[model samples]
Target: MYKDFGPTKAVTDMTLELKRGVVTGLVGENGSGKSTISSMISGVYPPTKGTMTYKGQPYSPKSVLDARKQGIQYLTQEQGTIDGMTVAENMFLGEEESLGKKGIVNIKKINARSAEILKENGLENVIPTKMVDDYSFEERKMIETARALSHQPEILIIDETTTALSQKGRDRIYEIIAEQKAKGTAVLIISHDLDEVKHLCDEVVVMRDGIYINTLTGGDIEPHNIRQNMIGREIDGSYYRADYECSYDEEVVLEVRNLSVSGIFEDISFELHKGEILGIGGLSECGMHELLKTVYGALKPSSGSVILKKNGVQLKNTTVSVKNKIAYIPKDRDKESLFQATSIKDNIVTAALDKLKKGFIITPSSERKMADKEAANIEVKMRDIEQQVRDLSGGNKQKVVIAKWMANDSRLFIMDCPTRGIDVGVKEKIYKLMNRLKNEGIAILMVSEEMMELIGMADRIITMKDGKLSKEFERSAGLTESTIISAIV
Candidate 1:
């Protein structure tokens, strides 16, 4: 895929197969040819020296429609739906000619059909008429899934699409896949979420540096074995942090009282101390994401205030929050975080430009040095810092986001599902980085969908249900995932 851009290969002589009525998983590190393989299968690009066949015939799709006709749907990692359109508008975008008369869009019919489609697909929370922008990052992601599913394709190719979905949305699509399997339709899922793969996929295929490593089935199937095959080495035990220092003064770094965001959440209040990792977990519709965004000042609160303190001092507004040592790492990297097609160095160093700036000018040499150091520390596997982040792997892209925040030296970090779509190796580094930051007296407020990650990494865990803070746990006292999960609902 990168042969024209540079004298490098994205995938070299790679061959993959998916049997009928089976779910096949394609796993690899960032820039390890997972996306490249997905592109070739989805007709985004053609292979240089190989053929991709379906069933018993040689098949090649020149465009997205060609791939779609062959019973293939691609939920690309990048934004695949139009941003300005409503959820229903994007859902039936291409096939709207049937509903419209003389190419004139019929809003009434479009919305009705969209609602029907989503309802049929088991997505009831997604409003048919809501503007795509107003929906949260994860909500919009489910809308994308609904769009891909509008065609009812036989062979479903979902690439990193489930990271943003709530458990309900995820279950809806998985049920559809199960139905398709009964009808003898083959499914291909490309995801970094190992738990999903283990549950959904019957067989697994591992790829590395554009080469086919091995395919594990039955007895050969395990997360560790798959990881070792993909990275060609044994990995660490825990993805969460290890080197943490629990010794810190009992100084409160943040305090919020009787905070409420109208219909989203009510009576939201919490206190955060310096050198503490606070985690929030709940079901998909529990409003945990809305609460976190409000804390970061990304979303306005109707009657709540976020107070940031260093040795007990309240900071001012949103700008002051970021300027006075607070950073918000969004839940959706493609939408709110990294810029695809931009260089990795640019993504990493964009947040730290204030440090590299003199008046209005940026120092390139110093910026490069800082970016390189951060990337190295995070173990970002990239050929060059100048390489575009779009072509990098999911795990590597996440590391770049982490590197960006670390470069800025933010004291209080508000992260929502930061490790949603990354591999185990990168997840471990993130845990280590969080511990390092907490040890340095940096306060972290994290919201995650993964219950185990919250239990393993968090110093204190908070549970939200119906947009209200219902329960809290102290990890210092040794909390269990079962206890945490039980409290969530």
Candidate 2:
């Protein structure tokens, strides 16, 4: 466990051994120090105290490159790739010098080499000639896997990197892990998806906030137990929002008509009441994302219009969507959300700049006050408002992002995958906040991959398949995981 963020420390007086040909999962919350453990093992950072012995030999890596030389490869939580460069260029980034022959950078040789590497790694579909920017985050990660495989490492370290992947991409990574296990190479994986940890790992190591809690092997470990250990408490009900009834029975606050986006969805329509929590469920590619984007005006609906009535006035574009008291929180808090380089104050204030200014002159005092207030409301764990957002973990960063838009006093909100990578502790707070907003008569439109969330939080769950509404379930009675799964698939 990390004692401090900067002078990070691995767990003290702790020892655990991973067997060869076995997969071991490290599970914890966002700042529970699991990633710190992985980083120390992978040589991203060495422990302040305590020595790591592998194969009965004292081992310490001065840098990531040093760790790679010792046959240990790390795939970071973030997908590391150059945007403008070709896939081949990124694959051989630092190792290009080794691939070079007689001080010559052979473009042809490298391209062919990248192609061969991808083919060997079961990713021949990703062309070496294609620009890295052209590939999705999952595709790029696969390319990175191929690159790591080319290094012929012994033990592979998969940091919490799989959440960015699609199902197919995740399957490919699983296959890679299996291949390495067959070779008797030890596997260490870190993940927030508890199901993934259970299925992939032979043994599970659970960590609480900055502490090594417990370790359990196959048959001995249970999912509920693991979750409890991670949170350090017993939880009631679902991870999603608590049950509540709609308070308003008046006219629809938002209406969509024939909303269609090319390559996304077809003519679809829906209405949201002024105070209701609506859940949209679909398979990974069932246009749920497009639906949320359309409502938030993030994507221009090809032929349809989202007519939002606020105090009997209609508004269109996202600029007006906000003006009409609508707010949307995206799923990818790291990517399409938080401003990492700026302070917490900046990220929170940037969203509502107009509120902090007197005509054209901005007030720093007002901005700081607003930022502090929002942070406090969201319970954002940070040292101070001046603290850079980059230092915070996934859960805290997401809280800051939520604070930004919620500060706008929106009447209607659309949240897309808001709880993707966070842990249950932060998740509970988010659920409580949603309930508070719902009680305040704010309409909520949410799309979540987790069925348990839909089953618990939504007043009504709408299932979509192939761009059409497949089914709808009311919260009045008889809603379960099995029921939602049946409707979704």
Candidate 3:
């Protein structure tokens, strides 16, 4: 199939087939057209050229509902559940007639059904009657998975959905996929994590520059081989930091003293030093995410202070933090970090507006120069800076977020899952960038669910359990996932 957005060719002459009872994996670099192909197959977008055949018949869907009616369901990488709607409502949205008689909908019947689905999918704690907006990103993702599975789809497309999920949620998804495979359902999973693709997929297809690459099966489904085929090059084995020592300056940059956020976290005290990479790891509900946001001044603490040691100013809001040259890369890039409808240039230059302005007036050329320089510096794949950020892939959207902060020349970066949903190549770039930032004496407080990332990149690792610091490990060859997992679990 061929898909084009204006002059940009998202998917070019992509020919593919899914086999029943077989799990297919799609691996590609950012903007390499993995999601686009999945979207077309699920009827989210129409193909410009080429055609698809399903069950020995021509299949062309006009809309997502049309595709779902034909036993095809998709769960997108982005937030798929609607806010202000109950979990049950969101699950049975398009098919409410099944849960009602005549023209009236039976809310209780749907809620009970939704509850059963949630329990079966290992999300029994989620209240089906509660609004989806009240749940965390990870919970909402599992809820979306439940909704997709409720239909018993013949073809299921999981478009990078696991990137937002915690390990428990991911394991639940794996269980569901295994069950689906046993039922002879064809499953297509798109992921940047090569190991996940290797573990879950029976056959892996590679795509590059919107064109179809070779497909690997059996023993060929290795990380290095998949990485090379996706990026068209051989990446070094050492994709993370090489050092085994925890070294940083004696000067402290930010200090959190007795930080308490109501019931979220309490007595969270830590000192971030210059040139240090302080990594925080924990379960999705352990409150580390809220702690990072509180320190960044995005969340109001019940009692305690986050002070910038440079000037001894108490951090109270996002404006104050940004003005103090502190950057934040949130995990929920779409809703929390990016202005979806804005141009890439606008998004990048928004952070550097203070520097782009001369006195009180800012020129268009100055904005353009700053945006262009930072976007190119981060190597954001786009037709031009004028393109909307929502048009870019998940990894590219992350690049735009990093580029925006880079333009501001931030002194300290509070990154939450900085490499989440990004490809290995961009992850390598970010790891290298973090190293460079640390070498230049910039402090980094990174919160990641990926223990390997913390072990591989951090100078010091802190694990959180039940809203409290459980363990702190200094960087050494002895640091491993077992040590960290012991603290978290």
Model 2 C-alpha lDDT per residue in residues 1-489, reported as the tens digit of each score: 233555433355445567889898888777677777777888877676677887889998898878887899888767688888999998877667776788777778789999999999888798898899998666788888888888777788998778766667788889889989999989998887888888888998887656777898877567777888888888775656544453454768888888898888888888888678888988767889878987888888778778866554434567877776688888667677788899999998876877667889988899899999999988887778998897777888889888988777777889887777777788878888887887788889999887777777778889988887888888854678787777767
lDDT tens per residue, model 3, 18-51: 9999999998998999999998899988899998
On TM-score, the stronger of 2 and 3 is: 3
Clashing pairs in 2: 1-11
lDDT of 1 at 81: 70
Which numbered prediction scores highest in TM-score against the true structure? 3
lDDT of each residue in 1-489, candidate 1, tens digit only: 222236567787677887889989999876778878887888877777777788789888998777876788888655677878888778777677768899897889999988987887667877889888887666676777777777777687878777777777678768877877887778888888776788888899998877888888886767778888878998867666553434444888888767788888899889888888888999878878878777776777888677765544444355666677687877877667888979989998887788888899998888889989999988888878998998777778888888888888888888888787777667777787887888888888899989878877787788998888889887753567788778876
Q: Candidate 2 — worst ten consecutive residues by lDDT sum?
A: 1-10
- Poorly placed runs, candidate 1 (over 4 Å): 1-5, 96-116, 123-130, 241-248, 311-316, 476-478
Q: List the residue pairs that clash in candidate 3.
A: none
Off by over 4 Å in 3: 100-109, 119-124
TM-score (C-alpha, index-matched) for candidate 3: 0.96
Ranking by TM-score: 3, 2, 1
Query: Could you tell me the lDDT of residue 228 within candidate 1?
Result: 87
- Runs of candidate 2 with Cα error greater than 4 angstroms are 1-3, 6-16, 237-248, 311-316, 486-488
Ranking by lDDT: 3, 2, 1
